[model samples]
Target: MARWESGAVEPDMATQAAMATIFHVPAERLSALLWPNWLPMGELFHVEGVWSPENCHSLLDASGDLMLERRGFVTLAAGSAAVLVREWQSVGRAVPEFLSGTSEDIALGFEGRLPWLRDLEDAHGGGRVRRFVDLELQYANELLRQTGHGGAGGRRLFRVVADLCRIAGWASADTGHLAAAERYFVLGLRAARAGGDRLSGANLLKCMTLLLAEAGRPQDALLLARSAVDATADGPPRVRAMLTVRQARVHAILGERDACERLLGQAETAMAETDGQPCPDWALYFDDAEYAAQVAACHLALGNYAVSDHLLERTTRLQPASRQRDGVTYGLWWAENAFRLGEPERAAAHLSETVPLIESGFSTRNRTRFAQVRRLLHPHRTLPQVRDLDARAASLLAWGA
Candidate 1:
């Protein structure tokens, strides 16, 4: 057991089967799965137990530890993920009951700081803000344990904690802690459900959808993405547009061009309907520029380099300077598209513009993208422009090291 835990060796099939039996997992499952993947690791397996305050508290406790201790991306079986989505869909939207208290003030105070924390993350990246967000989530969890859940005050507190969990989950993913991200997202979904915050729950589902897509489970991702859209069908136009765009992204990944295009059109129409109307604070960031950038991602996946480049150009121009991480990401995408179009010089130029931003930013995800772009440009290294970009990227990689 110690050897297995320390990565020194693998358990043989017989031992794995025995262990599965000991853990109450079906022994027959061992033939198709390896150790750990077969283990019911988180609250997801027990999603149907109940949404009581006690269960939410237990989930918070487990997920807080998950964020701190778990490592690597644990791929849940596709069927398990589908089960989770189905349970989320069937869960009642009623707020849970709780002991009345004044935690509302505390929760409100935390809420007041969310926008600033989000801005800080946008400017600097997840590595810079992950610990801070984790600490906030911990504190919120502690508060929840103390205050109980489901009154008006408790609902507000749960919603605030859910938002924190959302940010924490994103930060975890940004820093390459995907297992932790998945757990935190599930925790946030539970909290949102407890609070009856359907919009917040939908947002968490959307985040999970993207995470799964990035993890190479587009089928599961598509299921969750559709669930997110269905959950928020009556939400504000901007929010609906944001979720619809995400669904379009999944369709693009699955090579369903017609479905992708249809969803994109719907997203655009919904965005147009916003017309300056009020939107939830969480949905405010999905403006025209962000929309274009996301659309560019869809086209990028569909192999429309020229169209993606055009949309990304507009995204770069319209993106706020304060959104440094996004600027770097969009710049890298633009570079990739340019290179694919047989314009190495243009690609290198755009890549060069992102060097400084990459230097100042702290996102592992962006850094990975930068490395991929570098590899894409490697064949053209004989070109003077590409050579220069290569040297610059090398310097950034060395600095990161």
Candidate 2:
């Protein structure tokens, strides 16, 4: 695409007008001036056989910063930082959160008390393996700051920053940046401390448990779940429930069926206390569907596929459109469970919808889980839906670099 303000290319009348509005060009030259900065989303995405460079240039408004920010917000709006990172990865590049390739994360990253964010981004190049550890480091730092930074007002301040850290960490984890995700979880812990919110601390620990399980370190994840329980032994009922839900998943992943069932009982007890009481600030992450989805996932991991399917179907019904990334992610899990229970056609149907959602997010963490979907498709490549999904997965897997 040509630069929006550049006096280089000559333009047709319509193109000039469109470019002028996009770039704030002087009205006097609207008829004669070429609008250089007009790249479309498809072109910016570099979708193969989708759009020519010229068409892309025409579609974009042509301010590099504007273009980058627009694209970045699109990903964020979709509740997916992973998608943004993945697409950038696909292009063999790593653009900073501010969409800058010219600067290092530390020097120009988001200017809050988030030094850890930079560290998380710097740890990966092309998708090596996972960035969980790096994310944990950041999560730890954020928690430290959030839990005790402002004395009496510490909790409130921590609330603000910790929220960002949590989202960043979860995003990192969802995308398969395990190290980076872990750092965010740890940072969230510190934030809980700074805020003097024991409930928040417990929530962070629960997050750690989930991350550990997701990373296939089920034993360690189970230990983290115990720690979460111990940390929040005297905390709010809902907080306790969060920990139990987490523990249930960890135990299920470890194949400790008895322990997982027990934890599920505990989670139910905690949930029973929701008498319209205000939720703890840290627990804001979970609404109804979020809770149901976690429960369903735990069941799926435990080989109780029928119950899992029922719970998951309910969860999907309750899932708000706003939770697109999570909804899609969980939908993939449901499909996997269906496959396990011998429903190939349903699996294919789910995969067809899910592959596009995952692509839009480009999250490495979700991609790791999504590998299950890919595996299922690979075996049934002769099927139309399976072949289509396999191709999409292949394109995305290339970004795991």
Candidate 3:
């Protein structure tokens, strides 16, 4: 056929072109011959290593409106070459509300990826940040890749990665893995930096400060919290409030009531100006229950058992397990309050309850706080359960049991 023919068309060429495009097949280009002598459908999910274009064409294609979305699970999506999976299913299987089911349909043959993603998270965290180091690295790697792409989507992903890193760090600190928590905190800082969010970085630093405070290094925690506060002062009201509250927590740990109270007042002032000021992303975790609970801990540490008791009871009742049961801090709060109220039996009981959750298990942050409370109980270390718990707390008991 000539390139330009007057009122003449080649039916053979037109049919060949239409067939090639219709079935996603390679056509008569020189490069097509150099395509490694391999089939064009080498990337098929289940039916690879065979010429299956005819079979592929037999399968029904989705319409323009046919769509499937992954609400939270990114792991399953990445398992397939496509980031988004379309809706296509078979009979006799239970309809899954989440993206956790296996893909058995011929058109969608890839299985779920959420389990692998969760495995990666667990390997780093061993179920939480305090128990796993291997999984933390992998989780951070995944987040780093996701946040590398610039734009609103990148920022959104960066925020998620940042939150996960912070969670891991917090869990690490709670489980007594201070160094691992610190590493997570650093990665969280990097994630925040990727999104150019100073407030998020400040929040990560706040987490780090809490870790230090939990390690019985209130001075260090106070310093870190102060640095975060100073850096984020002009950024957002909520960010500033969170830093100040953390600083107050450090001071409270140090038994510096006056300084702690001042910081608490600052936090309140920041919170009171909610009319026009914007809340930084970091402070979203802060609320009335949190403030009250933290302040109660401060009082408990400072020997104000009555005030601490009131606060602990209120906070505990305020947020039930249906809402959040992983609050090792709340457990510590109740235990300390019981200890400070001259209730050795109750204190020991609370310790017994909180110990398994904090000492033998997760939360180095909780351990350190428990240790502090244990120190407070040192005056009565000779008591029965206290004697048993003193060993668990690793307190200053030099003599024989």
lDDT of 1 by residue, 1-401 (tens): 53453234777878777777887887666666665556555222334457656788787776646546445463454486777787777775442222234643657777788898888777775655777877787787788778777567677878877888888888778777787787778888888877778888889989988888987789888998998888877777998999999999999999999999999999998999998676667788898899999999999999999899899999998999888888888999999999889898898899888887777677888888877787777778898987887677777766445
lDDT, residue 17, model 1? 74
Q: Write the per-residue lDDT of candidate 2 for residues 1-401, one digit (tens) a residue.
A: 33232223456667756755786766765444223323332122222221222222222222112212221111111112233223222322211122112333231233343434433322321122123323333443454334433333333444434444565556555544454455445545444444444555556666666765554456666666776676666556677787888888888888889988898898888888865756654464466677889899888988899999998898889987755667777888888987888887778787667777777664554566677576765566687767666666676656543
Query: Model 3, 273-336: lDDT tens per residue?
Result: 6546656433544666666787776777678889888888788666534323335568666876
Residue pairs with backbone atoms closer than 3 Å in model 1 (clashes): 98-149
* Worst window of 10 by summed lDDT in candidate 1: 92-101
Global Cα lDDT for candidate 1? 0.79
The TM-score obtained by model 1 is 0.86
TM-scores for all candidates: the values are 0.86, 0.60, 0.54
The lDDT-based order of candidates, best leading, equals 1, 2, 3
Question: Which of the predicted structures, 2 or 3, would earn the higher TM-score when compared with the native?
Answer: 2
**Model 3 lDDT, full chain set:** 0.51
What are the root-mean-square deviations of the candidates from the true structure over C-alphas? 5.2, 18.3, 22.5
Candidate 2 runs further than 4 Å off:
1-150, 388-394, 397-401
